[model samples]
Each structure stands twice: as C-alpha cells, then as structure tokens.
Target: MLREFLQSHLPQYLYVIGRPHLARMNYNELKIHILGLFEPTQEFDSLKIRELLSTDWTLKLTDKAVEMALLRYWRQGLLSRTRRAGRFQYALTERGFARKEWLLNNG
Candidate 1:
C-alpha cells in the first residue's frame, strides 16, 4: 500500500537534468592555441589558460573545460604537468614544441 501511494505522488512529469553544452573545439585546434601560450618556458594553471582563451571562442568557456583539455594534451605528451602553487601547472613538452613548429610552418 505504501509503495503504490509513493508511486502516485511522483510528479507526472519527466525532467531531464543536463549540463550546458558548448561547441567544443577539436583537440588539434586547442593544441595549436595552447602552443602559442608557451614561451621560452612557461607553466599555467587552468584559470590562466581559461582567461587567455576566453575571448577566442563565441560560446562561454569554463575553467573545467580548460583543465580537461590540458590534461588530454598532457597525456598525449604535448604538455608537462606538475604541482605548483598547490595546484597542477602545465608546460609545453619537447614533442609539443615540435607540433608547434609544424603548425607554424604548415598552418
């Protein structure tokens, strides 16, 4: 009896919960964009990256998205990740430099 009563009380409407989605750029495009940020040698946290690229895209960009992209590049040997200022900071790797060179020449 209790189970039947609870089922009837469940709102007769269906609600779909989801996060706001953006037209995510391809990883290679981000790779090129991020490569430009590296200097002789530089490290950046998620906040710094988001701030740098915020004006480039039309849709809203979040820090978490930047972090995930950074991590993906880092995993692909494009960026080196390390702990700095109590958080993970990233720098371009040698492979990243080579990729950057290719972009500069071919792009």
Candidate 2:
C-alpha cells in the first residue's frame, strides 16, 4: 500500500519540494552515457572521464560519483584499465563491446 502511494504520489511531492532529481535511470541510459565516452583506440584517464560526464549531461555529478561509477563498471568486467606513462587509463573490454551492441539492438 505504502509502496504504491510513494510510486504514484511521492515523486511529485518531492519534485515540488525542490529535491534533487532522484528518478531512477535505467540501464540503457547509463549504458549510452558511458558508451559516449568510449573511444575505440584512445585510453581515457580520470580527468577525461570526469570532463565527459560533467559536460555531456545536464545532471551534474561529483567526481567521486563518477569514480564510483567507473569502479562499478570495472568490477563488472565491462571496463579494463592500464598503466601508461605513470597514469592509469581506462577502456572498454570485449565484454563491454558486446554488451553495448546488445543494448543497442534490444532498445
């Protein structure tokens, strides 16, 4: 009962109260945002990733949030990292490529 009420009405109340947009973003939204930063050959470092996330989307997230998202993707085997020139660079793994394709097809 309470779950239904919140699902239907609480969101509007929250919005009217000037709360941060807490709408749940689905996997496709997350995937598209991440894939937009992915380069076939270029490796992304932390600064590059943060810049991409901040400028590309209207939703402004903190650096720590971006780092956490990257870490989550890394743990999911969708991202790989390497050390180059004393800095860590990130790229999508083979599994990530396949997943991206799948999401594109299904959505």
Candidate 3:
C-alpha cells in the first residue's frame, strides 16, 4: 500500500542518481524517516515536513504519505499533535523520541 501510494503520488525520480533505487522503507521505517523533519524536535504540518524530506533528493515522500504516517504515530501515542493555522502541527512524544533514538542506533 505504501509503495503503491508513493509510486502514485511522489515524483518519478528522486535526485536521479544514475539509477536510483527505492529506499525499501516499510511503514515503520518510513514514518521513522519522517521524523527527520522534526529533528532537534519541533512542530510541523504535513506539507512543511513533506517539503523538507523531499528536498533530501534521496527519499521520496508525498504530503498524503506524511499525513498518514503522522496520524498513525499520533494514534499510537508516539507523537503529539495540535491544530495550527488550519493544519496539524506535530512533535515527538516520549515514545517517539525513544523510538527515534533506537532507530538511529540500530538502523
């Protein structure tokens, strides 16, 4: 489902590294990767975070992908969200931070 969604919504290529390969990220990994946008930890809407992650020119992400991941995180109590400026702003909760730490060390 994630791959299908990305293939549909994301650009055809990400930075074009001769022959780029998909990151092979699963749902948990992709959501964890999304945490990059909040590094140093701050709130951000789906669009803002999507743009930031997309700019990496390596990973491909769509705003809808981000929204889905974020909502999942929120539902799992991994992140906290608040509505701001007609959009949802998100920050890592304790669980998120811990998971991020583990990901950094293990991934």
Candidate 4:
C-alpha cells in the first residue's frame, strides 16, 4: 500500500523537480546512487558524481553517457545546475530531496 502510494505521488513530486526520466530508472538503485551526492548545504559537482559512480559501481560509462544522464535528469527537473568551485554543480531539487528522504525512510 505504501509503495503504491509512493509510486504514484513521488513521481509527481519528482516531475516538478525536472526528473521525468526517473520513472525509467531502476528506482531503488538510482536512488541509492543519487543520495550519495547530497550534502546538507553544498552542491556536488557533476564530474565528481560521474567519477564516483563509475568507480564505485564499476560502470565505466563514457563521459558522454554520464553527461547525457545528467542532462536528462536536469531536463526532468530532478536536478538543478550551478557553478561551484569553478565547476558545474548538480544539486537535487526540492522534490528530488524529498524523494530521497522518502526512499530512505520507507525502503
């Protein structure tokens, strides 16, 4: 019941944040990966995320693939871009943050 509710409501929230493609991802796995990028008051760099995930997950995806994923999420409204430390940073939108909290608490 709870999972059903989340599946319905959470996507709506995330869509508002710019992550329409999130529905296509393996939600649990993607959530775990994305949560690692979060910081209380700091934005995470996109390249760092790609590198970390590539190393940790042994993904070995090309830089273009990583950039495509990032851009997709950005277009979906799940992430926002900013400049930090002379690099492009990707931060979870409010909805993305909320979804992460939900996944953590409920999963």
Best-fitting candidate, measured by TM-score? 3
- 3-53 per-residue lDDT for model 1 (tens digits): 232223323221111424345544454566667677648888867777777
Minimum summed lDDT over a 10-residue window in model 4 is located at: 14-23
Is 3 or 4 the stronger prediction by TM-score? Answer: 3
Q: Model 3: runs farther than 4 Å from truth?
A: 1-23
| C-alpha root-mean-square deviation, each candidate | 17.3, 9.8, 8.1, 9.7
Predicted structure 3: clash tally: 0
Comparing 1 and 2 by TM-score, which wins? Answer: 2
Model 2 earns a TM-score of 0.67
Order the candidate numbers by lDDT, best to worst.
3, 1, 2, 4
User: Alpha carbon lDDT of residue 33, candidate 4?
Assistant: 52
Clashes of each: 0, 0, 0, 8
Candidate 4's displacement at residue 4, Å, is 28
- Order of models, best TM-score first: 3, 2, 1, 4
Residue 1's C-alpha lDDT in candidate 1? 28
lDDT of 4: 0.60
Better of 2 and 3 by TM-score: 3
